[model samples]
Target: MIESKLISKALFSDKSVKSVNNLKDYAGIEYIASMNQTHSDLVTFVKSSAVYDSDGIYTEEPKLGLVVKTADCMPILLSDKKRIGAIHSGWRGLKSNILEKAIKKFDVNELSISIGPHAQSCCYEVKEDVKKYFNDYTELRDGMFFLNMSKVLKDLSEKEGFQVEVSSICTICNSSYNSYRENKTTARQFGVIWK
Candidate 1:
């Protein structure tokens, strides 16, 4: 079993939120806004606290937390102070530019993005075909390819002008978090933020 601690403070990239009972609570957030996460690029602006079928959620509404759940996939929290959003950025979601879609909902401005714990290149092996999707980020070792999922998000965030911070933990390598790729488990950790 993994040591489940209250969200590590040193591990946090921002001060927008904190983990609570495997469920992080964002400051000033009274309600929670999330998506069903279909691994698509679909991003929705939430009107209420209800969860819906989509990959991303954002809002300017105070006291409403924007959250996403992930095991191996990346949970990205975005905040520009004026608006906050969250996305379940699996490989499929990245390939489709879900972050880009999520940013569209907010007006043109700089943003802060944080990538929560997830599977990293050292533990996330992939097929050679995945290379075509990325320019020069994939690596080869003993004829097997390992994908740098974190880099993909960082690069994309840079291109979109969003300042980014990433968690150092790898879900697959560290038992503290769940990884469907490592154990095929359904357990997940939540990444939450608020505006």
Candidate 2:
């Protein structure tokens, strides 16, 4: 009962109210809740309208929509036409395999995935410790290490037996996209999917 869509910048105004309204506009889905987003491997399932009261945990009511906002972090979308999930995956989240964990919670063979715009390694410079977490097979250019998050997620989706499509847009490289690294004070964008 879940479907994925990459919202255009015009829909989200970098404001929570506007973003939430935009989501409502697209699918009549409301903001149930979101997490503090520590970039951990924690994956929560939202199933009720009440879950929106809290942001850090999962719900069980199988509601109509779910959302996650991001600046540089990866917004991982999951759905199978009956249930749906959205996760914020930064380097720390990626290192923890949050996407794998989330997908495992559902019967996702027929699920579809969409990796919303996020900070690419091209614009996401990290310290050595953070850099070391990714496999050495990751691409590098211009003295900065880069990971094709969409590719990684797409591969994972295929492995999980779900159909997948990825957007090549890079948040950091594209001026149209919102990026925490590019503008420290700018607002973030929402990556939303629901059934």
Candidate 3:
């Protein structure tokens, strides 16, 4: 049994489909869309349920959902008056410039962003070699590297004129969400946004 309950528990009673029903029911939307997700910078502006080999997707169509699953990877939802996006960004995706790719499609003057739970710098330690891809976003402490992905993402989005809101919960620190770094499990927590 899943101890941590979601915002809409009734939609998740049958966990066989993860939380798709929760999103559909909570948002009152019908169509569900997603990507194959390769941890790359690929961002596609989609309109239907057609799956693509990308890490991010956005749409302006009503009653449609843009979904992505994550454990430790950051789930970013980009929104504006006319568009909505869901992104999957880990260190690799960030380094590949996924955020910029997703934001470029929308008008920043009307955009507002929400970053979902993920592994924060407080527990996300990395090797020194991986530090070369990021400079201002990472810190070297006690001969180890820690990444502030939320800040990096916030800074980047703000630079592009989007109002950003980051999640206070960390997947590694909060057992409510799944974390690969904590359990080496492929199980992921779903994050979705729709129009």
**C-alpha local distance difference test of each model:** 0.71, 0.60, 0.75
Q: Rank the candidates by TM-score, best first.
A: 3, 1, 2
Which segments of candidate 1 are over 4 A away from where they belong?
Answer: 1-28
* TM-score of each predicted structure versus truth: 0.83, 0.78, 0.87
Residue 23 lDDT (model 1): 40
Model 1 scores worst on lDDT over the 10 consecutive residues at: 1-10
lDDT of 2 by residue, 1-195 (tens): 123343221122233434655666766665445555666687655555443332223334444456677777777665554556677777777777777777776667656666766776556666567667766526667666666566667677667678765555677877766777877845777765544
Ranked by lDDT, the better of candidates 1 and 3 is 3
Candidate 3 displacement at residue 5 in angstroms: 19
Comparing candidate 1 with candidate 2, which one achieves the higher TM-score? 1
Q: Which candidate, 2 or 3, would have the higher TM-score against the true structure? A: 3
Residue 144 lDDT in candidate 1? 80
* Cα lDDT tens digits for candidate 3, 29-115: 788887888889998878787677889988889878777778888887777778888899999988888888888888878877777
Q: Report RMSD for candidate 1.
A: 5.1
- On lDDT, the leading prediction is 3
